[model samples]
Target: MGDQSDKGQHPANSPTPYAPYAPYRRPGRRPYSVRMTTGGSGIAHGFPHLDTVRAALAALFRRLSHDTVSTFPTSVLPVDVAFDDTEDVHLGAQRIARAVVHQLHLPDARIVITFREMEHAATVELTAGPEYFVELNDRFRRHRKDIGAALAHEVTHVWLHRLDLSFPGTRDNEILTDTAAAYLGAGWLLLDAYREHGPFSQKLGYLTPEEFGYVLAKRADFFDEDPAPWFTSPQAYDAYTAGRARARQDARRPPLAGAGWAARLRYAKDRRAAQDPRRTAGPVAGPGDGYAFEPAAGTGAPLRVSFPCPTCWQRIRVPVRGHLQARCGLCKTLLDCDT
Candidate 1:
């Protein structure tokens, strides 16, 4: 997103995102970034839902606060969600649902789990409730193993509902729920549920496999936890690897001080252009990696650099003066930038 939009588009005091931060909403909106592929054959492979996912992360930090977010340092363990084939189906389902609710820190959220033939993996009734009703696809009764994944998603909907944190449309709200689950711990089940083989595929939630991996990787990096060894699906593991590369790339973007030599070289040239008194007096578009330079605010004010925080994806605007440290208002991650 080589953003060249005017800064005025984003009102300084406005809560809603506009201009550079609203990537998914910028292009006259997109038709539900990914569809629910219960059959799993059409499982999206990459990061189309990235913008909403990033926004969701920011929202979690904004709503829950950094201290509250830090409370979930551990991902849900595999044993907690296990379902034995010989066990009573209803007992197993309830057990897994309780585990997911506990992991989400929703002790008061009673999620009653049931099964039915549904086009989607699961659905949750999001009303004012200490008790929420959830319906899992009947397929999980036989498949058994994936009951954990479906419950995790539906339970998270209840969690988001209670917090009153959501996006406008159904598609974006679903993406938020998935991102919240993964980032708060318990979303790795959604990623691990994804499996693709000849004539067989299955994925849960609105996010693509890679998006889930990306969120999970973000959580893992912050908590110093590794989830790769827990993946049972080869395809899910591959998506996680690809997603990790994308997450790592965020820290390597220009102006962050850790940017690669090539990126630093390019950013330096863009910085030069912005500083040139004779240069065209407007915003200069950088590469697609979400960094750009704007002209000085006044005659002598320094030109500013705007970029996304690798942790929460919130846009940060800093002056052109070199070698400064900045802290993101959201997520509270400190950065050493040679701006």
Candidate 2:
């Protein structure tokens, strides 16, 4: 997120969350800086809500120091914090970078934060900056809760980068990082906001409210806690309802058949499908191919057997003799081979 204006800024103090630290400074590296703006008005129009969010986050952080000792395992160190009244993207980027370097003790990693002037029509956007760095926009900084959340979110990314832990080729990696932050307790404040306001409702281009809630739920499950109280969004409520139903269904189902079943079925189906030229051309292959053979020809080549989705009752096809890990395209229900 990028800053909205360039006035009424304040200098950071020692105890301030934005204070820079000695460990964060690097020789020949540009320092990170922050700028705050003023002269905006209206409760729904500008920075007031953002300020409220920021104060809440600060209070939440202070409370966490006392209430969540077990949740956050990192050593709390002094950090140098500051804000600016300029839109110089380079300076804003440096400010975030300095904060991370000073706060965390990761020596081998190089961190950079960047801001860009995006079209006003766009919401807040974040991306991996140059050379193993993370970037946030000024509009993001304008919203205090979003700033805290974005910082925590990006910091988690840096932590994961340093640890060489990442999911392969999916946005799910970012979601995992968000979950990591909530699990670690730094970003649960953001999660709380998300639960309240719903994600992206503030025009921040991050996770949707349901997506945030889903990850929060996953984090709670990982830590064995009840997530209901922390949630605040109507979107979160709906997701929780759906998630609870799925959990109940999972509880009633038998254990998955295992890798042996997957391997056996995959090999069997592939082998049969490869050998039968007719199988390539139409729906039914043959009676002995382990598929429920139907002579109907217009339903397209039956690569799998059709079953009702447990959640929605939509007709879904599962490979008759292949790995049975398919999920419903409609209701997202995962299926086992036994129908």
Candidate 3:
């Protein structure tokens, strides 16, 4: 990693050797089984970064603690980043940069904003100082509206760096950054930055548009906030809808009280398997199942089931008694379970 490296290739996720949509894998990271690489589609849609995104959410609660995570109850306001085309480029960029810093709660951090011709959307130096230098792609000089989106991402890098939280590799780590940006209230710009039409497309941040929506949806659910009215791009709203639907499904997984009949039926069968004397109970017995069963802790103790907390994806274990509310120790999200 060098200062020249734009947060995993250039921040602009176009298909290229240095771009995100390209089939570029870091040296030691394992390749995705799916063809998540860039193609004629331009922007890769769906939940390609899903696993990493979930892990990122868990990492957020783990590092920042639930109380700190709850403090970001509101997303960045549209007024905070508004830029008039007639506004001075340097001054306006600095203003937007400061807005991002303030919204992200980097009270002591000072950002030096500059623009130059570059392949990435933006880059920020992760330094120990109270001052950070951010270089924006020269294109942003003309496309001022997205300056907020770029700074939202780069400033979040500073926030995460300060928290000293990161994932293993470049790709997952970038996903963590993206997830933190969205869930912590500054990332809606990333989703709003997505615009695709007539073979031309632009997307900011590492998470796919849907993934951005998913994290946003998760944030909204926790804070009881709605971001639908903030999106100027219909495509972004639609992607949010799709991602929100997916996020809502997390609560409907088997063992959760809200689960549908089919899932509940499956859970019943799995429960039977766990109780069967011949079957060995373990953390997992099937693929695509969000839960597993473990043997009872003591001779008379009840059999226990383990499932992921819909909020942070942290695995939660509870006794196999019916109608219990489990609160995730990590994110502190309370859930209604029927195990």
Candidate 4:
């Protein structure tokens, strides 16, 4: 009787799968929701089309060919392209590097591109691979064109860095990189690509589709053509439509006064003076002074003070100065003084 048998007894306590274990609470002030949602500190919207992108690059290439001065060193860089076996993002970065290498004519610098499956989602990082190495994002694999464009853009940054052209804190440095790309004959393509995938959003400090268009437009103006037609994308279309409308409106609006009006009046006066010598000679001293004035001509006698309306043929007085508003006696239509 010292110990009771409990082999057949059911245990009073049990654990349920659905039992709440205080929910997985995040530590340290919830780590800020906005910070968590914003994936990276880069802009991430508005991408452009492929053809426009190519055209822009081709244009840049052509320009670089024509430039007498060279911003890049005489020696060229070597570039190696490869994809990450484990991650899909590496494909895009690899493709972009290849495109850049293909387009560039460097001869001395060695560049190795490798794809690595890293913890980060997708990014392009520059490193010293004995020469230079870049790690590309996996997402780029699906968007080949964007990859090429983005890689070209970053490569440009590298070029600037090597040249000691980059300045800290000033937007001018970024602009210089962009300008250098264009000047060397790839600006339009880069701009097109930028428009296609460039960052945009007031809240995010990214370039908007419109801003991309505007930049492309400026680039086009620099080259003297409509960049819109070169590359066709939703962003390009919207920009072109808006730009065309603005141009038309601008054309219709009267120019500022002064020189424009003076020119117009001068032309008008010259034509009138050529047609009537007497009018230009001098005003008559008096209506009937000794000056032998020609008879009131044109209709044999002076035009009748009142005459038949041309439309209804009713007698009507064409007012002196021909500046009075009147109604047709027969047609009852309002008539302008000049008419």
Candidate 5:
């Protein structure tokens, strides 16, 4: 059922986070200190592809594994007090989450924490009003490490709910939520919370442990912060390693383009990249079989040719011209071009 706790309210005293508010912000919503610049090669770091995200995670975990031998590094936020059976860590997590939301200057947002016997570890009761509530499973009282992650997930719902953002469907919405939690921050906690040892294990988040690693790695790369010191769970580390392998496998095999699933995949890619100003919105084409029509230097409709890369086979489009080299941004492969 529900985990009962005496500390249901926000902690009276909590240390302020370092750099509580900084330059980074969500795309198109404002507070982005600078726009990411993209070259003609369409290479930039703002809005990233799935494969791009995967590669970043692989690189991060490799570094983390090398740095840790016996104990976790001391740099991560501490939550040992929450681990006590008598203490409720939810209040502390709530304070931390509120600080994050405050950075965005979001208004009057209130989150009421409650416990229930729900199918999910936690669920948010989103509403149109300024105050919303979340229910957590009772098991979290014993699994203190998961408090931050659980609150992060519910807080993510609160953030997204306020924005009223549109998605293709519920699954896509959940994906975006997971991506936001990792990208905006709080991802490291989610990854650290993942545990699978003998009969005791807990994972509380929308994304799979692997997916969490991918986004967390990407965020870590953006901020230049090393999270290896913060990871305390061996099983969480294992999940990241496994995710890295999967990312590599996925990178080797690019999706085939056709009028069927290929077209649908392209649509999804566009949706993913739409909010990213660093990405260029090219004409929607059918894989590599057709040309993306572009307006000519003159008034006439100019012809643009697109083709697949020789290495990873990802489609690349450039205006129809003569001999030049086109770089595949996804895989960084050079293609001999005649478009």
Candidate 6:
């Protein structure tokens, strides 16, 4: 086949041009299908077993961002590529979905993109079969800036469905999914889609643009990547800056590295209590089970704080400034210390 310049104008029923780019697949494997429903609170109420989820996502994104570096597009997509026809929208969505799935190493799975004139922005049909179907609200055809983020969010549903992961209930699964999309890399596109000017604005995704920015900023911080230049929307850039500030504020809390399971349980409780309104007293600074604060010397020295590692119960101390690296002397466990 010859190289086609306008890939989007290809025949409607033909296979996506991206099919040849699939990088991962096992021979003689039959595709399995799983059905999942779409309807729940988009608000983030946190998720159960969050620590484990975060740990898994951290490892997955570390590999995906490094190995599948080209999964994301190289150039910034125009935020105003409007479409008047649903077929054109579907074609564009297909191209974006192909790029995302190929990057995630899912060479065998095929996703069918369709559209419906609906109130909700978009949804993915999680069926108990191999074929994946994503339906976008036809309204989005006019709001082209959201195409990438919406497709990324739905495509993430397919990936998570294939992994057979689910939260305890429906109330927070959407938030978890949103977090996965952002933390896993697609969330950057969502943040970049955020647009607001006076009365006209468009924000698309399971989570609010601010929440998306928060997760993206957190991931960028983890990967040591600068996300400022990637942002096209001024509103998104502002949200990202604010989210980074929040992450830094939360970083002031003590390290939960060396505590035992029981102690870690108590630490979670204490951490929540510290945020309770009735608890007006600040975090007690002492050399006890909880975090301890060390007074600075003279006038210019920075105050240092210490916390027990969740792994080996060793107290690690560092200046109360920005995030720093720490190594437990007893267990020799390396840690990323923010407190």
Alpha-carbon lDDT, every model: 0.79, 0.40, 0.78, 0.36, 0.48, 0.55
Question: What TM-score would each prediction reach against the true structure?
Answer: 0.85, 0.39, 0.86, 0.38, 0.53, 0.58
lDDT of 4 by residue, 1-339 (tens): 111221122224521111111112223321101000123334333433322332333333333442422333221111223233353333334344545544443323444333333342222233322243443333333434444444555565565554444434434344444444443434344434433344431111123334444444433433444555544355446654553443232112111111235443443343344335356343222111111122234434432123223222233454223235566544443544321
After superposing candidate 5 on the true structure, give the runs of residues whose Cα lies further than 4 Å from its correct spot: 1-90, 103-105, 242-339
**lDDT (10s digit) by residue, model 5, range 1-339:** 232334343434643221111112223331101011112332221223454333333322333232221122222354431345544455544555564454323564554555444456666666665764555555555555566666666666666667665245564555566555565555567667766556555665546677766665544444555556667888667666655454343322222222245554563464334323464555444343333433344544344545444333345666554456766665454555433
* Root mean square deviation (Cα) for candidate 5: 14.6
Question: What shift in Å separates residue 168 of candidate 3 from its native position after superposition?
Answer: 1.7
Clashing pairs in model 5, backbone N/Cα/C closer than 3 A: 2-138, 3-138, 320-339, 321-339
- Which TM-score value belongs to model 4? 0.38
Local error of candidate 3 at residue 183 (angstroms): 0.4
Q: Residue 63's C-alpha lDDT in candidate 3?
A: 81
Candidate 3 lDDT, tens digit per residue, 38-112? 224657789998989999998888888899988988788999899987776666776777877877788744446
- Measured with C-alpha atoms, the lDDT of residue 168 in candidate 6 is 56
Residue-level error in angstroms, candidate 5, position 196: 1.0
- Candidate 2 residue-wise lDDT, 40-111, digit = tens: 221122111222222222332333332442444442221322234354333454454455443443343334
The TM-score of candidate 6 is: 0.58
Local distance difference test, candidate 5: 0.48
